[model samples]
Target: MITEEYLMQKLSRTMSEKLLRHARGVADTAEKLAKKYGTDPFKARIAGLLHDIARDFDDNEMLQRAKKYNLTVSEYGFAMPLLLHGPVAAVMAREDYGINDQEILNAIALHTVGSEYMSQLDKIIFVADKIEPNRKHAGVEGIRRQANVNLEAALLSCFDESIRYVLKMGFLLHPTSVKARNSLLVDQGSFRK
Candidate 1:
């Protein structure tokens, strides 16, 4: 089992100072959310810390790692190589960090683009990544407020923001994100507010 300190050291070596701070912020937020939602705080913290492990890779490096790991890359993912980092990070977490927990791996993998049916841990990590203390997006406060009342509602709000941000940036929307949002809307039985 890899210790949290060891993971932090690994992250320090791989990420820039700003990114390391962001990872710490995510980890703290994820740990708190895990406690609030009655999940394992340790797992949430670890997953949050490692979620962006491969984020610093350049386009070619991301594509190379994705191919090396045999990940199924979507067209948007190819265009936006950053999207490939999540799955690549997951594989790295397992192989290099010796993190064998599927829930933790899934949280790391699905944090950027949520899954169809998000587990509680997945929701925690995703929300924490968005609403961490360092994040200052326009809708962040609203989602943080919703996070206190309902996990799913906050997740939906976060996803909505993500979709809009992608659209505004002229980036192709990843189908995984759309499907995750659709699943949440269906599960909640509601449309865009």
Candidate 2:
């Protein structure tokens, strides 16, 4: 099994100190949520730690990595280049880092633009990335508080914020994001809203 130390070493060498610390914070938050939600802590840790692995790479590097992994680059991913990092990192984690777990890869892949069939670990990593202690935003506190009570609800809140932000910024919305929101809304019986 790949150890946390190994992952940390790789992360430290590739990312700036600030980004590395953020990754660690996300890992810690993911572990806490995993314990609370009865999810696997190991998977949560890996997902959180590697969620932003592609951030340090430039656009060409990101695209190369994505192509190397056969990830389809969508119009939304192109417009919002940061969105490609998640899926690219997922591929790098598996192909380069030798991470063979599908759940972990999926969690990393969908952290940015979540999908309808996200697993518990996926939801945990996604929420942890958005609401880690170091994060500051207008409504972050509310999402953080909701995470403790209802993971799904917290995801809904986070996705809603993301959607609003994208719309306000005039960024193209990813279809996966919309599907993710719809999936959560359906689960909450608020799909019509």
Number of the top lDDT candidate: 1
TM-score of each model, in listed order: 0.96, 0.95
Candidate lDDT values, in order: 0.92, 0.90
Colliding residue pairs in candidate 1: none
| Local accuracy of candidate 2 as per-residue lDDT tens digits, 1-193 | 8999999988888889989889999999999999999999988998899989898888778777777788888877666677899989888898778799999999999899899988999999999999998899789999999999999999999999999998998888888889989988887897554
Query: Model 1: runs farther than 4 Å from truth?
Result: none
What is the C-alpha lDDT profile of model 1 across 1-193, one tens digit per residue? 6789999988888889988999999999999999999999999999999998999999999999999999998887888999888899999999988899999999999998888978999999999999999999998999999999899999999999999999999998888899999998888889666
Count of backbone collisions in candidate 2: 0
Report lDDT (Cα) of residue 158, candidate 2. 90
Judge candidate 1 at residue 100 and give its lDDT.
Answer: 98
